[model samples]
Target: MKMLKMLSVVFLSAMIFTACNDDNTTNGKGKASIYITDAPIDDDNVAAVIISVNSVEANGPEGWETIDEFEEPVDIDLLSYQNGEAFLLTENEMDAGTYSEVRLILNIQEKVNDQIQNEGSYIEYLDGSKEPLFVPSGGQSGYKAKGEFTIPVGGVVGVTLDFDVRKAVVKAGNSGNFILKPTIRLIANQDAAMINGHFEPDNLDSAGYNKVVAFAYENDTFTESETNEPAEGEIRFPNAVTSSVIIGGDFTLAFMKSGTYDLYFASYDENGGYVELIGSYQDVTLEAGTKLELDLELNLLN
Candidate 1:
């Protein structure tokens, strides 16, 4: 598998592909509907995270199984799939059984005139500026989505890979080049859950703080790394499974695997950097199809 330097992101530019060979099929076939979505990013400058995926594959007992491949590279805007929204890749029958991992392959590095050319994976800023995201090369685990799923004998199994774009994307040192890391959660759609709610502060507004990023971490897993300044190639809330920007007195953390979590709100300082943890919601249990709606209040930090 290709290693991402630090974190990773998801931009599944999905297209229909033919199924695997008959040798990989079993006595019974099952259906799989794969989708991709992204967690909210706090970077206000980021307007669109466009990614181009050439194919989707799974690791099976028979070996690397092909789920689907694209005849044409599709440019998918990950930012559009926020707030629990998902983009379906394909819904086709496959070998019945369990697969340990799922990954997305980016064919951006194409040889044109015997030269490596990056196709259409880049980030668009609010100011109309753009920069291409550097996609690394390697095995089927290029995107690094981790999970275990079983395609039933005669039923459909739907899974959504939550790409935490905020974490997966980091600038390469002082080079200004953004690298797309492989950091994603492969969650069974039936067991995936989300946390969404309104948090209108009594005396706080967007202008009060530079930024308010809501993070969801496994219960009691939050450490100082979450609030402290991140390393040169990392971001705060490093331990958070997922996070979202608190906008218009509303925020959402979506596609979390079923579990107990601690939701914390951190307000950035004047420099637009993490300063302190201002608000929190502890011991929250979430399940699929159910949204944990929280009515929260923000406290002054500055």
Candidate 2:
């Protein structure tokens, strides 16, 4: 009789443990993962690479928010090219709740050697400051996601940030010193389709920094003529938007109506001007119920 009782007790304990685990993983509960991908968007002969998000969460509500802080220090090695990619697992999972905001936080890169690095290259600042901005050297860093979005449980949330590295320019603060990159996080909310990334620039030198310019062909003949060759020429029929400069981090035009359009960008330094042909006159058909993300990079020779 004693032996039988002992056996029964052991069986009950095992069953209890198993049930608890199942409750954590299933039953409308558990955590998600934020996957990162490094790819380049091509333009003309230049290819600019950027790291964007491709993450998923389980049993998540239509939306979620990042706590705005990291639970612990995340080690980011900025030296090796491979270090450009990173991921952090949340300490606690988002409980099974109706969340509407999806948030994320990115910590600064951990220092490897005495010297700091940004964009995998050595930097020089205006005030003779050793470290420059827009590269990972070390220090506190991060950016909040734009607005809220709705995400369903067991669903995948996809986001891609297309940037022109060669033509993309970042302005440093008044100090004009320090190495860092833009850190970002996202939150979920109702009508999540209205999210956008804000681009702001700081002035450091009187000579000025690089900027992107927006241009479109004047008439049907000009646009069709340059369909294959992305080149610069005089505008024959200038739309109300004759031209605009691409300065700071944001240099994109929203296309409510899309067709074939020729686009180009230029850079101006004290040395003079360098023209960059971003894309040829291609027929870009923008239809309803679609999000068009066409970011291109170009080389500007001074």
Candidate 3:
């Protein structure tokens, strides 16, 4: 896939706020800044992966508050924010307390006639292939993420929402249309780790399966016999940093929290299709500010 570079445009308003404080005991409110980042997907044919984000909402003791709202739906090409790079979505002063949920409201759009119009969020490929990216029922309510994080009085809290495109876009049966089943995770910028490696497929052609997907399951076990069962642990799909395939068949999965994780890989085809399970490494431990490297020879399922 051809890599493209795009500059981020921040839509800031004239709202004055106090600097974020690191200590929680400070008087009133703290600053919370949210960012948008992507975990790399292994699809070579896609030229752009665009999504429309309307607003960001956070739930605190004061019920729900709009942290950031876009006057118009902002179309973001996620492919540009790979490998730890991120764009600021919104920033606002929030109360100094534990915020339980953060939600993103997406505006799905479509192409009508020759002009690109807002019907809903959709994906367009380099081959001129297009698909409808549908957000499920709950997404309309908001893509709600649960976690208890404190905005220290005067201290700034940075949250990065990782959008894993590979896991989020699902093909609708034999039809060419796709569904945007968004798979997202929240990572505090300060507590993230990395995992890198090389994937060597014995007989697969590089062009056919151009993308590599790494799935991280925290505190989980995956036995070959239990492949059909839903395993436990937080599954950080393709959105983890270093999750995209690099030149020379190398892959990296970054922004992982410190824990014991089971890492699995799979081959992704040109048409946004997952070929098969490449292989997996169990009991992989990650620590803060540490990088784990593991090169693997993929085991073909068939």
Candidate 4:
């Protein structure tokens, strides 16, 4: 059902956009750009999700005018960019106005008799195995994230697309084929916020944590027992808006809108299984363009 709903959103704006010749056209225009980021997937075995992007476009006077064009499709490792980190997809000038949506033209592959075509998009595993990350009927068109951003006269505006890989990558029922449903959002860079913090490393005296995942749930809505697994395609923290993987005692929950949230920390086993809820804090509010910091003490697990 989730995959169906996601595909429905994709089909609504899956039109194709052609390449545009660059005239170096920038005079009395506003600078508009797009960035790409991701949320951590809850699978420990997977090393990366690679996607090839040809160009990025915005909805404007010419239907889909290419703002930034690449000579060759760039392969991006989505996992390498997360936790407030983003890759600049494009940066160019446009006439000052409101744009409806951003389209990322992915160079996808065609499947022939259950075999994938040349390297379109695929997943890399820790043990050196790769499999096609299929996007249904996505090769012939574009995928989009809908949002509104206005460019001021002679001003610059940046929008970041947050790709939630946890919800976007799903396996076919008993088939082992992974599909990408493209759950994404566009946030103006000036209006984005984040919660970042450092964890005091505590070697649990021979029972140390293997992995930790941080979640920013709706304010006052997180529960200790939400860590229990639900259905197959869903995770425990249903109300979580964003998540981050704690790396080297640092974690950042990025691309969040200004709102109150409850931050929760939990430990995961090597296989990404929920081990236990480490701790949580309530009523943490964020304002636009601010990075709130919280220093987690080591005694939270006691």
Candidate 5:
């Protein structure tokens, strides 16, 4: 049997800009730009995951302000922006202040020939299966994320929103349908860090796999038993600082915060059907703006 290789890599780009006016006034306006990226999910059965974004908005003490709007909705294939790549969404000028919320409007429905059609969003599977994926309350109300951030005068701030596809895409029980719940985080570009390395398997060709899965746990006491499934408060699978997929023995988990974490790696078959626990390291400390490198060997038991 010829097995297909599935590798997972995801990224999100949310650039926040705050510029100083000519007079450097306290309440002056600045330029705010928005971008979109993806954290890819590796599944042999899934061929494509597409989403259409229409507009972006931000809220502050004054009121809700429009950052960027698209006359035609932008269709994005989440899997394509892998390995730390990103694309621009939109840009606009806004007053300098602390924005408390951000909103993303998606194209879930459209009016065609004087009739409301279901021309919103969909996903394609490897088995030639296609289905519509719905976003609850995302069309009319838009998806809103709340956080407090300040744009200082004479400074440019870049923020990144990491969208995790593994946790956001849900499969209905035996129904073969998928739902997009959207798991995202807003992080300051300056405070971000990365952890990357290479893994060498004993037998590369016959290993039956093409990628290795890496996970980071905040708790130092996390063990192998907890990795079999997602354990609330213990194992952070989808939102786990950065659950990276190492391709061709190389991997990089970026945008991590400064702290101590437990790192674990496992090998999976090309079709993503089989998995084996290689090993793990505990108390790995990550500093801000620093790239920490660590290498390992996958020792499979006979």
Candidate 6:
């Protein structure tokens, strides 16, 4: 009878020990989040940059198993700021395991069709949502996080991705006579290797209806054709004509390693009877990752 009692006591102690260990270890999961701010941006209305986290997994014996098993929140927001100011929040707990890869997707949601009617024409493309944009590359498909990162179990980490508004544009819908131009905005990263610029066409179109007006604005001020003078720029409003439209070279800019920059393009006559404002911007990393082109358009009703 004494021997039987001792066996029962040993089994009960083992069960208690197992429960304690399970409580101490992390369930295996982490969190990620980020946003953008308009630093020294002249405009009051600023767009928000969105961040997304997905495809979280480990590189251990189990392979790339989803962390769906964890019950905690996977995304965290540290804080937010107005204009040049911003804040961030970090997740207090992270999976206590070593991870091989963590994939993240970034994008911006802007209201399309917002327009200011100039002259008698309704020359505006406003009110719609842009497709999801991938960072490091302005692709319809979200870009991938390059190098590998590891998350310590139950530890917290915060990451910030700064995007300049200078490189964003609004694309208008078709179904109109004249093709309207896009409004331009510029955003620059101090360490960014590329900058955006624009130029005006030197000649008219095949229809011989060459009433084109181009302007390059800096810091909300307009200037004449100064393509080769100081800031070096070029442009071709009616880029492609029905029978034949001249092709102007690309508008590329070499930027300072670290500093602020801004530039934009607006055209009076695009093609046929259309007024267009097309602008191309991109999210540039210090390394030459990828260049994104935002082709925004608008049409005027005469």
Top TM-score model? 1
Question: For residues 75-116, what per-residue lDDT tens digits would candidate 6 score against the true structure?
Answer: 322112322232332223344444444232222222235532
lDDT of 3 by residue, 1-302 (tens): 11212211121111122354445345577878887777665556777788888888998878888898889877788888765567778877777777887898878643346554455566777878777675554235777666666676776777777777756666666545566664677766556566665655533454366666666666554445433422322132422323556446566566566788776766666565656667666777776555666665555221
Q: After superposition, how far is residue 199 of candidate 1 from its true place, in Å?
A: 1.9
Candidates' lDDT values, in order? 0.72, 0.30, 0.63, 0.73, 0.62, 0.27
- Model 4 TM-score is 0.81
| Model 5, runs deviating above 4 Å | 1-27, 109-118, 127-129, 173-176, 201-210, 221-239, 299-302
Clash count for each candidate, listed in order shown: 4, 23, 15, 0, 5, 36
lDDT for each residue of candidate 5 in 90-204, tens digit (9 for 90 to 100): 6566677778777788886444465545555777788877777766666766766655666555555555555566666676555554666757655555565667666665544
Selected candidate, larger TM-score, 1 vs 6: 1
User: Model 5: how large is the Cα RMSD against the reference?
Assistant: 7.0
Ranking by TM-score: 1, 4, 5, 3, 2, 6
List TM-score per model, in order. 0.83, 0.34, 0.70, 0.81, 0.77, 0.27
What is the C-alpha lDDT profile of model 4 across 198-295, one tens digit per residue?
76666332348888888888787776667776676556776688888888788877777778988787788878888888777677788776667777
Clashing pairs in model 4? none
Best first by lDDT, ranked: 4, 1, 3, 5, 2, 6
Worst 10 residues of 6 by lDDT: 1-10
Model 2 per-residue lDDT tens digits across residues 1-302: 00101112211121111112455546554333332211111122222222221222322343333422443543322211111122233323345444433333333223457554223222332344332234342232222223232222333222222121222223345645433233322322111111011223442123245544444332343433332332232221223112334445443332122234444333444332433443332333433222334433322211
**Candidate number that wins on lDDT, 3 or 6:** 3
RMSD to truth, every model: 7.9, 18.7, 8.3, 8.9, 7.0, 22.1
Candidate with the larger lDDT of 1 and 2: 1
